[model samples]
Target: MLGPLQVRGKDGPLRVPPGRQEVILAALLLEANRVVGTNYLVDLIWEDNPPETARTQVQICVSRLRKLLAGADSTVSISTRPPGYVLHVDTGDVDSLLFTGLVAMARRQRDEGETEKAVALLKSAVALWQGDSLTGLVSGPLANKAHQLDEERLSAVELRMQLELELGRHDRLVGELQLLTHENPLRERLRGQLMCALYWSGRQAEALEAFRTGRRILDQELG
Candidate 1:
């Protein structure tokens, strides 16, 4: 579930029934293969104060989600345990998990000085993101989780560009780096990489300008 909440069967894209059921399914998917306690599920759905019927409503949501999954012929199954529910799904089926694994592999390749391989791996990892993670479901505790995943994605992109720069592809990276720095002005690593790219491309004046812009942004934002 990288972008919007999606469940696909062997045939095609499976339609996730809307409303609270969607939220319940998302919460379960986030912690697939583990039991998410009933209380935690309640908090995820209703936040601080849930109504007297919150537990019942949660059960209803889970039942509906199970039906939807079964109807879609999905291999995943939700098991009712003592405390709550567990969504049984393969790790490979989740885009976020695949992305994380790819990033980890890329990091290892980068450490081994395999710049080309690392760049390719990172490119594939970043491509898994269709849009903002958990879109339309970013509320409650999931907001922070989404933000963390987004930061990871940005780091992967920065690392990929850094590898490209190391391979003397600085000239080709200038435009992309410029846009990245503009989008994440306060990210020192990206700014530093941008400066290096600009300098290597013989754009010395622009490199100095980039540093100045970063320093000014840091002072304005942090001071």
Candidate 2:
């Protein structure tokens, strides 16, 4: 699940049901093709303060989601098994799984001495993320999962930038690295890449300035 929980129909994105229903749908989709226990769903949506009828509510939500998906002529479906539910969708339909798969393939390409192919694969992987992972959702575990996904995205970007630098694209990477560093000021690897891009482009003063700025930010943030 990237950005908002968007489910597309044949025409476009199907209108997702809002609030806790959306939360339930998201949780199921996150564990797509696998059984997610009703208990786990309740705990996730309510988190230490579930109502007495939480399980029933979860069942109801799932029923509504099944209807929504079916009515839209969507391929996605929810199945009821003992003690849990399963969202039966293709592996490629889930963005997070596809992202990791691409990243794994990209690593293989890098190992095979095909850096350009690796970078292209990574570009596609990162493109799957529309914005912050799981933006505007509640549930602490899902938020933590989102943070983990965001970190994965950053690592992929870091690897891609490293490969680009090795390919002698320093001059072209300067502006893009500047923007990335600005967006992620606390990321020292990105800061280091920005510095390298600047120095290799004959902007030594700016390179040093970038270091100084990063140092200040790290000290303030870490301390």
Candidate 3:
């Protein structure tokens, strides 16, 4: 039932259990930060021509999910609206949502010449992602959201590294950046960051080597 469902972690690979309840929660979270109407929820979960108990079923699912979230975090809320329900989860509480906020804030701070704050914020955001976005969730709108959030998070890291180089933190970032670039060989920006870090670390030849390798990988993979 929804009572045993977990968000992303805090139990055995947090996930909304498989069934109509999971379907309902997915629909709500898809539009997290906004309201979803009763009719629309019915349509999403049951598609065309729901049974006579459709309304009752939706109410039950929402109520159960609300209870599960309550057990996890009291602030995680699903509130009533005239037409339906609103999921009012803070963007900061979820890794993907928080990652987006941090990236945006870091960019603004960087633009304002607040490098230290920008680096700190960006690092915190990137650190929240232990692995791929939505580690346990299957493909869906939520999966797409997780992927986009991850891309934004990576961009934030690149931006922070640029500022770090400006602040001469290359020696500190070089090893980690090397591993990052190796893991994401297809990411030219990450490779570029590693190159720049090497260059700023006073390893001009190695920096050039990094650039060459990046270019070769790009040519081979992307042509």
* Candidate topping lDDT: 2
- TM per candidate comes to 0.93, 0.97, 0.75
CA lDDT scores, all candidates in order: 0.88, 0.91, 0.74
Prediction 2 TM-score vs. true: 0.97
lDDT computed for candidate 1: 0.88
lDDT of 1 by residue, 1-223 (tens): 7788888887887877666777778888888899989888788778988999999999998998888789878998899997999999999998888999999999999899888999999999999988887788735687777778899999999889878988999899999998999988989999999999999989999999999999999999998
Better of 1 and 3 by lDDT: 1
lDDT, model 3, position 221: 93
Which stretches in model 2 have alpha-carbon errors above 4 Å? none
Can you write out model 2's per-residue Cα lDDT over 16-92, one digit (the tens) per residue?
A: 86778888888888888899999999988999999999999998989888898999899899999978999898898
Tens-digit per-residue lDDT, 1-223, candidate 3 = 1112246534434446677667666666656778888887777666667899998888998998887777665566788887898888766555556666787888899889899999999888788766665445433544565566667766777788788888988899999899889888998878888988888788999999999998899899999
TM-score for model 1? Answer: 0.93
Tally clashing residue pairs in candidate 1.
Answer: 0
Ordered by TM-score, highest first, the candidates read 2, 1, 3
Candidate 1: deviation at residue 11, Å?
Answer: 4.0
Note each model's CA RMSD in angstroms: 1.6, 1.0, 4.7
What ranking emerges by lDDT with the best candidate at the front?
A: 2, 1, 3
